[model samples]
Target: MTVATTDLDRLKSGADQLFSKKKLAGFSIPLVIIAYLVYIFFAFDVPGLYSRADMDNARTLVADSYSYKMHVTRDNRSAEVDISIEGRRNGTYPEDGSPDWVTRGEETVIDLGQGHIATFGPEIVTYTIPGYGTFRAEPGRSGVNATFPDGDLPGWINASKNRVAITTEAGRFTVTRNRTEVFRYFNGWEAFWFTLDSPYYGLSVGEVAGRAVQGEAGDIFTAFWTNSMWRHQDVAWALFETVLMAFLGTFGAGLIALPLAFLAAKNFAPLMAVRFAMRRMFDFLRGVDALIWTIILARAFGPGPLTGALAILVTDTGTFGKIFSEALENVDKAPIEGVQSTGASAIQRYRFGVIPQVVPVLISQLLYFLESNTRSATVIGAITGGGIGLLLTQAIITQQDWEKVTYFIVLIVLMVMAMDWISGILRRRLISGDGTGH
Candidate 1:
């Protein structure tokens, strides 16, 4: 009875210590998390970021992604007015023709719906806003002379000695010493299928289909495929280049890493020195980012898809080597011994025994990386000046081509999705084949 009491007391003491540690851990963990969060909040300067944010520019960028703008511009020096879609020469109206909303004669009158009208005369531009009044600006050698409505100038109108800018819900107007421009926002992609020069430019879908049935299919396809404004052919080729980069990089990495993985695997390489060297090599490869690799390769190979491919290959090789080596270490030895007992050579043993065991893992990792590398290739392409990334960068650099940027982004997303789907299918097939001894 005395011994039992002693044992019970010991158990009670151990339980009390465990509970005390648990309580301490529970309290300490939360305190540490809160402290780190506080440190980050101050370090990142969240308040300063909030202050620097511009909601108006953000709103404009968002709007530009979904919509297009038509420009009605008049050269103040020459008094020549031109109406073009997005101010592109290929999108310019034929023979100085104008949209129905714009009336052209001695003066050009653009009717921006909702009681906003702009008239462009010889050397002067006038904007009439309902509930406000007429605003006029005449550009001369000195500067732009401006006049505003009767009351105080509204916040939407910015007028100065050199330029006058008016922004409203319907459109925007800007007048400078060189040019007077009116921008009208429109919904949908402008001249995406057919440019202003094409005969099918303004045709309805039904009408286009009818014309196609009448043997105009080739012409319509040609017009759309060769659209100068959108450059559909060039975009398609760029997408292909991006895919190629990912393909060459991922498979090339896998091929190069498979053999090197044997050197890195602790079980395979008998020499500790060789194993350590291989591991450090892999560390060097993966430790540096893919972007850095892209820059280095670009310097060596010049700017091209090939440089991007090499970057991906170099970066992925280290990753694959580490993963494959770990897989090799965990492999079952029974099959390898069985093959060796049958008088199999070292190479044959690996092929018949080790490879069969790890093929599923190998294929699975390769496919997953292929899908991920497709995305990486895009950024790499941008750095190397190849693939759709180049086009995306160009569009963004222009600043006014946000719609084109949106289109490129959508295409990139679709490309990645397609790669993911294909990789999934390929992975399934490969795994099933391995299971069936194929």
Candidate 2:
């Protein structure tokens, strides 16, 4: 009876210890998480990051992605007036041509929408704001001599000895020693479908379609496709190159991996040394990320689409090797033995029995990787300077052409979506060996 009572007491003690451990673990987990979060908050300098963030610049960048601006610039020395979109030479207006908002004569008068007006005269530039009255500046060798209205200077105007700038809801104006310029913001991307040189520049959608129906479709398409500002043709070609890079890399890796997988698979490789070496080789290849390989190869082979493709191939070969070897290892032995029973050669057995069983997995993995590699190729092309990523990089580097950045991003998203759809269809059809996706 004493032994039985002692055992019961020991069991109760053990249960109490177990319950204590469970309670301690539950409390300790939450405490540890809280401590780690506090460490991260300080380590990342979250307060400093928040303090450094600029909301105005963020708003401007976001606005630029969807809208474009027109520049009306007057050379102070040459007395030459030029109007252009985004101040680009290719988007400049012809000498005699001007938007309806501007009147050219002895003085070039610009209507900056609303009640804001800016006029360029022989020696001075004047801006008239309905509620704020008029402001004037004479830019010359001395400086931008400026005059302001009564009361204190408004926060919207920035003035100095050499430069003066004014910003309003309607537009922005600036005067410097060399030039006086005004920027008028618009809602959409101008010259997207047709540039100023095109005959259909200002035509409505219905008008363009009517012109196409009248047998000018070829001319219309040519104008849009050859657009100097957007370069739709060049972009389309770059996209094609990106997809080609992915295709060549993915399929090339599959081809190289399939043979090596045999050496890595234990059932196929009689010697353990060969399997170890092949498996290690695969690990070394796939262990390094593709971007790292891209940088290394770019230095070796120089930069191009081929370099990007090779990088993808090298990294994917290792991955494919590991995956294919596992698949080969998991293959059913029944079919292989059946093929051997027929007195088939080793190669014939592998071809007829092993190949048929693993084909579905091979095709499925290859197609999925092909799709994933399409997106990877874009980033790889940026380093190699061969695909849409190059154009996207260039646009982002400009710091002013956010609309082009938007266009490139949209194209990339569409390309990825199309690849996903194609790969899904192929994965189903190839696995089922039928046209209808199962």
Candidate 3:
């Protein structure tokens, strides 16, 4: 009875210890998570970030991405009034021509749509907002002489001694010592395909198609492709460079990695030292991120598509070597033995036997990486100043051409999607041995 009671007491003690551990783990995990969250909150300055965040600027940026603005600027010194899309000289209206909403004269009047109207006189600029009274300013050498309605100045109008800016739903108007300008926001990208000089600028799609059928296609296409404002030709060439960079880098890595992989594979490399050295080389290559490699290569090769391609090659060669080596290690030995039984040479054994077993994996990984690298090349191109990414970066830096940024982003997405589809189809066809010899 004493022995049995002692055993029961030990069992109870063991159960109690296990329950205590479980309880400690349950409480400790939540406490650790809470502590980590608290640390991160302070470390990243979450409160300051929230305070600094400007929703108004965010909204304006988002709006600019989808819409365009037309600028009607009057040079106060030159006394010259010019109407242009996004204030670009290439998108400027001819001296004899003006938009229906604008009437240029000694005093230029811009209809900002709705009831809002902006008039730029020789010395004075006036903006009239509906429901609100007219806001007036005279820009001169001294300052912007301004007057508001009887009531206090509204928040929408920003006024100072030297400059006065008015903003409303209809448009924006500003006056300074050097220039008086009005910006009217509009939907859709302006002068995307054809600029103001092109005869097909205002034509409907159906009309353009009709003209294309009527043999004016070449003229229309030339006008669009050579457009100075949008630079469709430049964008097309940049896109081609981006694809070429990715293609050259990915395939180059594959070609180079295939042989190097054998040196890293334990089964193929008889000397352990050779395998270790080759594997370490691969690790060194892939260890540095592609962007870091891009920076290094750009300094050496100068900024170009070739530099971007080389960066991708160096990074991917290492990754492919590691992956290919592992795949080679796991390959079935039956085919290799079968090939050897035929009195095949060593190279022939590898080619006819081992390669066949791992080819599917190699091809699959290559295609997947090809698709992934296409996206990476865009960013790489920006650094190298060679591809569509360069154009995108330029647009973003300008701050005035968010539409162009959107266009580039959309093109990138489409390019990536196309590459993904192509790679998928190839992966299916090659890996499954569909419509191909075993």
The global C-alpha lDDT for each of the candidates, from Candidate 1 onward, is 0.92, 0.93, 0.90
State the lDDT of candidate 1 residue by residue for 239-259, as single tens digits: 999999999999999999999
- Regions of candidate 3 where Cα sits further than 4 Å from its true position: 1-31, 54-56, 121-125, 135-151, 434-438
lDDT string, candidate 3, 1-438, tens digits: 999999999999999999999999999999999999999999999989978999887886799888989999988888799999988888999997899999988888899989999898877788888899888887778888888889888898888999888888998898898899999999998888899999999889999999999999999999999999889999999998998889999989999999999999988899999999999999999998898899899999999899999999999999999999999999889888988999999999887888778888889999999899989899898888889999999998887687888899999999999999999999998888732224
How many clashes does the backbone of model 3 have? Answer: 0
lDDT of 2: 0.93
Candidate 1 C-alpha error for residue 92, in Å: 2.0
lDDT of 2 by residue, 1-438 (tens): 999999999999999999999999999999999999999998999879877998887887899999999999999999899999999999999999999999887799999989999999999899999989899988999999898889899999999999999999999999999999999999999999999988999999999999999999999999999999999999999999899999999999999999999999999999999999999999999988897899899999998889889999999999999999999999999988998999999899888888988888888999999889999999999988889889999988888889999899999999999999999999887788732222
When 1 and 3 are scored with lDDT, the better candidate is 1
lDDT (C-alpha) at residue 373 in model 1? 92
Question: All candidates: CA RMSD in angstroms?
Answer: 2.5, 2.7, 3.0
Question: What pairs collide in candidate 3?
Answer: none
Clashing pairs in 2: none
List the lowest-lDDT window of 10 residues for candidate 1.
429-438
Q: Give me the candidate number with maximum lDDT.
A: 2
